[model samples]
Target: MAHTAGGTALTPAMKIAIAVIGVLVVAGIVVIAMLNTAGRDGAEAPPSSAPTTAVAPPTTPGPLPGATPTTGSEVPPPTAAPGTGLPPLAAAEPLVAAPLPKSGSRDGGLVAGFPTSVAEPMEDSDVVSTSIATENTAMQVSLVSSTTTALDEIRAHYRALWTSLGLREQPGDDSTMAFTGEFESLTLNVRTTGTGNMYTIFGVLRTE
Candidate 1:
């Protein structure tokens, strides 16, 4: 039998051919849709024109929390404690006295620059040794003599001499006594030399 959609008759081979052409058209339409979907997935979208927020850096540095601020412009100077400070020097102006003399005494006689204020051992005393030491700022005189004068007279003579010069007598036994004055100190030592009375005098005079 022959079938026709319009006026022409359709053969078996012609019908099969028409079915194949219809299948081919459907396949082409499916391929086109799949290609469009793949293109959309692969391509990047255009950037947005909307504004965005951003963080900014600080303008000035500051100390951390819990930090303490220092006080005042400077520290006060240290003060010397009472009695613990250096001993008073010669009891005079400027307070600090010069160093002691270092010269030695060898032969006998009176040393040069012996202070007239410090009286000699005695007119009859036999001199054992004498020395004179001088410095730019000070002078030291020392005398050693052996005398037959009475112990009381010898002591009294020096005691009166030291008192006249306004020196304060320091504590001492019968053997030694030191008289302290302004700018100087005088130490007189007396002892029995077995044969006679021996006396030694040390005078330190500070000049200017």
Candidate 2:
């Protein structure tokens, strides 16, 4: 065998072969040792918990900028009553103030008991009607169709019924005439007032 450096007994081919085998054995042992250690560690260790990712902090809601909260003392609503749609009422007439006055006559021509009187004359185309009223008595006089044309004829008729009866013909004020008369039964006071053509008669008839 040929020795290269010092006084070695091995040949060059043998040294090469020995070095290759030793490298192979060491590589094999290293692989087996690594596998054994991995098995042992894996078996002995407890299961690893998953990495606890840093959890985000719970998000808090922000308050509104200028909002106001309501208090408990709020105003209550109004309640309506029943029967809201009733109709309007009408105006009333006024009452008369004074008691009826005494009849116009003191005699019993128109009435038997009470004194004050008022009267009216109605002249239609063909007929005439007279109405007389007294404070205590009432009388109605009617003039039928007659050919009398003069107002004196009507006045004389009433005067002749009660001889001392006088005629106060009120053409303007509130009446047309206030006739005072005395009949055998009572005294009569007749007041006649006219508006346009229709004549109203108010009377007072009483005892003499």
- Per model, state how many residue pairs clash: 0, 32
Query: Which numbered prediction scores highest in TM-score against the true structure?
Result: 1
The alpha-carbon deviation from the true structure for residue 61 of candidate 2, after best TM-score superposition, in angstroms, is: 20
Q: Per-residue alpha-carbon lDDT of model 2 for 1-208, expressed as tens digits? A: 4565768787778999999999999999999999999999999999988888797866974445675545643466787776768787444221111343333332212333222222222233222333334443333332223333344544544445433333333333332334443421322232322422222233433332
* Per-residue lDDT value at 70 in model 2: 55
- The weakest ten consecutive residues by lDDT in model 2 span 113-122
User: What lDDT score belongs to each candidate, Candidate 1 first?
Assistant: 0.75, 0.42
Please list the residue runs of candidate 1 whose C-alpha ends up more than 4 Å from where it truly belongs after superposition: 1-106
The local lDDT score (0 to 100) that residue 86 gets in candidate 1 is 72
- Candidate 2, residue 151: Cα displacement in angstroms equals 89
Steric clash pairs (candidate 1): none
Candidate 2 Cα errors over 4 Å, as ranges: 1-8, 48-208
